[model samples]
Target: MILFPNAKINLGLDILRRRPDGYHDIETVMIPVPWCDVLEIVPAKGSETTLTVSGRRVDCPPEKNLVMKAYRALAETVELPPVDIFLRKIIPDGAGLGGGSADAAFTLRGLNELFALGLSDSRLAEIAAGLGADCPFFIYNRPMLCTGIGTEFTPAEVSLSGLTIVIVKPPTSVPTAEAYRHTTPSIPQTPIAGIISRPISEWRGRLKNDFEPSVFPAYPSVSEIKEKMEGLGAVYTSMSGSGSSVYGLFDNDILADCLTETFAGSAVFSSKL
Candidate 1:
C-alpha cells in the first residue's frame, strides 16, 4: 500500500509552562501544508521488520527511522507479517515541519487500513500520540488548535486556500530542545485560533507567532526571509515552529512565483493549503 504523509506548520506556538515530566506545556495552532513525504509499504517475506529511506533528509540511519519504529510498535500488539517500508522523504527534518511525526502517524493509519485493523480515527490518534506529541495532528490532517504538549486538538474553522504560501528552509538546522531552551514561557491572551480562521485580509495584524521574537534575534537571516515575504505583499508572515522554517501568505500565485524565483537556490516551496 502507498500513502503520502503531509507536513504541518505551527500557526502560533506559545510556551505556557514547564511540566515536571520535562516536557513543557504548550498552546499552538498546527496547520497542514501541502508539503509531503511519500511512503510505500508492502508485505515482506521474513519475520523481521525492514525499512528503506531516501530524499531530502537521508542522513538518518535505517534503524532509527520512524517508519521502522512505527511498524515495531504495531508488531508488539499484533503478531504482524513482515513488512517492507520505503520512505521517500520530502519535508525538511528538524525544521519544525513535523515530517517524522507525520510519517509515524501515516504508518499507524495505513497499517490499520492495510491490515484490516478497522481502528477508528480516535484509536489511530491514540497510537499516534504514543509515537510523538505532534503525531496526533496528522491523524485528522487539518488545521487545529493544539495544546497540552501538542496532544490536544480542536478543529479550526479556517480555509487558507485563497492564499499562497512561500516556505523557506535555510540550510542550517535548529534543534527543538535548543529552541525551547531559549524560549521563556509567556501566555498570550489573544484569541489566537479565532483570529487565524478569519479571512486572509484580516490576518495582517491579528495573526501572530510567539516564537518569532526569541528565534529571529538568534538567526537574523530567518527573520529576513519573513520580512522579505511581507515586503512583497504577503498578508501575513511568521515562523512556523521553533526556528529555521518561515512561511509567508499571499493572495495570488503571481506573487508567490516571483518570491520562489527570488529564493531559487534557497530551499523554498510555493504552494496553497
Candidate 2:
C-alpha cells in the first residue's frame, strides 16, 4: 500500500520544565500541513524487509531510518511477511515540521491496513508514541494540543481556514538535542491555547516558541526568515519549532507566491489552510 505522510507546524511551543527522564515537559499546538513525503510498501520477494529512499537524502543509515524502525516495531507484535519499503522525500527534515515522525507514523498505519490488521487510531497512536514524541500526532493528522514531551494529545479547536501558509526552511538544520541543551524551560503565565483563541494579530508577542531565543542567536538566517515574513505584512509569524524552519500566516494569497519566489533555493512551501 502507498501512503503520503504530511508535515505539521507548531502553532506555539512552550517548554514547561525539565522532566526526571531528561525529556522536557512541553505544551504546544500542532497543526497539520499539506507538505508531504511519499512512501510505498509492498510484499517482498525475499525473506527480509528492506528500505530504500529517494529525493532528499536521509542523513542516517537505512537500518536506523524511522521507516525501517516502524516496520520492525510493528513486526515485533504481529506476524508479518517481509516487505520492500520505498520513500520519496519532499518535506525537509530538522525543520521542526515532523516529517520523519510523520513518515514513521504513516508506516505503522499503512502496515496495519495493508496486512488487514485491524487497529483503531487510538491504538495506532499509542504504538506511535513509542517511536517519537510527535509521532502520535500524525496518526490522527489534525489540529492537536500536545503536552508531555509532545506525545499526549487533545483535539484543538483552532483552525487556519481562511489563511494562507508560507513555510521556509533555510539551508541549515538545527540539532534538536543541541537546541534543548541551550534552552531554559519555563511555564508561560498565559497558556498557548488561550493565546491562540485571541485574534491572529494579537498572537505576535503572546504566542511564542521557547526555542527561538537560543535558536535565533545561533542561526540568524532562520531569524531573518521570521523578520522578512513580518516585514511582508504577515499577520502572524513564528519559527515552527526549534530552528531552521519558519512559517507565516497571511490573510491573502498575494505574498505567499512572493515569499516562495523570495526563498527560491530553500525548501519553500505555500498552501491554503
Across 34-125, the per-residue lDDT of candidate 2 in tens digits comes to: 99999999999798898999999888999999888888888887888999999999999989999999999999999999999998999888
TM-score of each: 0.93, 0.97
Question: Which parts of model 1 have CA positions greater than 4 angstroms off?
Answer: 255-257
Task: Assess the local accuracy of residue 98 in candidate 2 as a C-alpha lDDT between 0 and 100.
Answer: 91
Error of 1 at 251 (Å): 0.3
Candidate 2 lDDT at 257 equals: 61
- What does candidate 1's lDDT look like per residue over 1-273, in tens digits? 999998888876778888999998888888889898999888876767688887875677887777777777877777678888889989988678898889998998888888998778998788778888888899999988898988999887777777788788887777778788877887767767767767777876666666677788888888888888877778878888886888888787745467657666568777865
| Model number with the top TM-score | 2
Q: Give the runs in model 2 whose Cα sits over 4 Å from its true position.
A: 255-257
Clashes of each: 0, 0
After aligning candidate 2 to the native by TM-score, how far in Å is the CA of 239 from where it should be? 0.7
